[model samples]
Target: MLPALVERYDYDPYGATYIAYRVPSTYDDASQTRDPNLLTDPAAWQPCESSRFGNPLLWTAQRYDPAVRLYHFLFRTYSPTLGRWMQRDPAGYVDGVSLYTYVASSPTCHVDPLGLTYIISPYQIEALIAELRRRPDIGGGLRGRTRTPSDQKAPTNGCSSPFGDAPSGVNFRGACDEHDRCYQTLGKSRFECDNEFYADMAHLCLAYASSEWQLAECLRWAMVYYIAVRVFGGWADLYDFLKWNGHARRNVSPLEPSRPAPRSQPPYTQPPYTGLGAGTPWCPSRRSPYGD
Candidate 1:
């Protein structure tokens, strides 16, 4: 019997396939091997040239035409060669920009995991908040240009108002106060609101709650409130909105979940992957197409 070959892939933080290695099954300690030929061979490994969805484990492209290959990114069909979508975004102009733009035209920094939704990982969120907090401009002037220490003074009554300026803490009142303050100061402008305050509110909500998922749901509702107030210039009762959309649950989480089985097998699940040349697998086995 022929010795089985084991292939391992290494990816960058952005899920880009940077290096790959193939080793014989007989090698008990492959990591200790110091073979220069094995390390330097060009044929042994290939870097992913495509911008978005570089990790082959998660992304599977279909060859509809003999000459061209297209990937179904859930939102639209993407042509790798053209580096654009074959179809316009299904969400229309919700991004308030070009529907054809990919990863908000920033592939290096951002990734659209589901193709339909743009998500920043919890680690990324934490890092971003830390960086933002470090900045003198944002941290020093969190209460807005006009507001001073006196203006941020706590309400006279013992009960905390959502708009009150208080340091974020484990208490829900503190979290809500911080979120409202973020909305007032940073969320007034759409650019600052989405980029800075929204994430800050998410962090604050998560910080106060014991259940991360439940707090995530609250964050979603908070976003809806911000959108209604700032974008549409309308009022929405938070209680009414939450009650109406009670069925809505948290889908995104900070920690990774176990890989679920694919709903359906792809057409190219089997071997004899004729068109795809050497190095690439016929289809990923055991490993998930979603990122680890």
Candidate 2:
């Protein structure tokens, strides 16, 4: 069997499932459309241009970064086994459900993680899901391609900083003046963002996290919390929200009872918070009323 990404349905009458990346094909970032009728009405799906990198599709028309481009490409290129086509059903909608038909091999419905069984070695289904999330492409030929950081040779100094603070870390020295600031200080590689260019890195990270089948939804919430903390005075605000006391014991074991039990005559009884008997031995005469 070809090494592929698979999704199975346990309850379907037909032993139907999906296998992605079964064939090696390049995906064209352009020429995709988001027509809804194609999903609701299979007849609406016509031939579209075949991608040299991915399974080719019949050419319906040309488009650039359409919302449903990924779905259109997958369904149009998918070649099911003989005598069977991907069935259209409400349950089949996983991620791209709004734009394509759902297929199943059995009738039993199951959830992610706990539902998926018998995965082969060295497989990560969540990462694959993350890559499938659609992001709006405002420009062309610069999204997924790779390059080194110093490719653009943008000026090391100027107005390219994201925060635009003169005290900011963008000053690389000896490259440009304040009017020609370098773009590397904006949280991207020096090569990726040179000349004030942005790559939608944040959206891409969010999409990757959202698509993972194994990652819980709470992770997304935690990310939101993390962002909020950074925006509003960072760790100080986070600590305040946590109600952390300055003197909270560090490295203490909760499993092993605390140093002083509540009934055992408080830790220190010195004058005005001076009860801590430093370098003094407890007098035997001062026995507890409750005995040892």
Best by lDDT: 1
Model 2 misplaced regions, further than 4 Å: 1-133, 136-202, 210-222, 244-292
What would you estimate as the lDDT of candidate 1? Answer: 0.37
lDDT per prediction? 0.37, 0.24
To one decimal, what is the Cα RMSD in angstroms of model 2 from the true structure? 27.9
Give the distance in Å from residue 229's predicted Cα in candidate 1 to where it truly belongs. Answer: 12
Q: What is the lDDT of residue 243 in candidate 1?
A: 42
- 1-292 per-residue lDDT for model 1 (tens digits): 4332334444433333333444333334324564445555555444433323233433332212212445555346665456556777665554445666655444444455434433333344455445434542333222232211111333322113232222122222332333344334421332333333344454444444345454555455445433433333233332343345333223322222222223352211111111110101111111111211
Worst 10 residues of 1 by lDDT: 272-281
Candidate 2 to truth, TM: 0.17
TM-score of 1: 0.42
Best by the TM-score measure: 1
> How close is every model to the real structure, measured as TM-score?
0.42, 0.17
After the best TM-score superposition of candidate 2, give how far the Cα of residue 38 lies from its true spot, in angstroms. Answer: 35
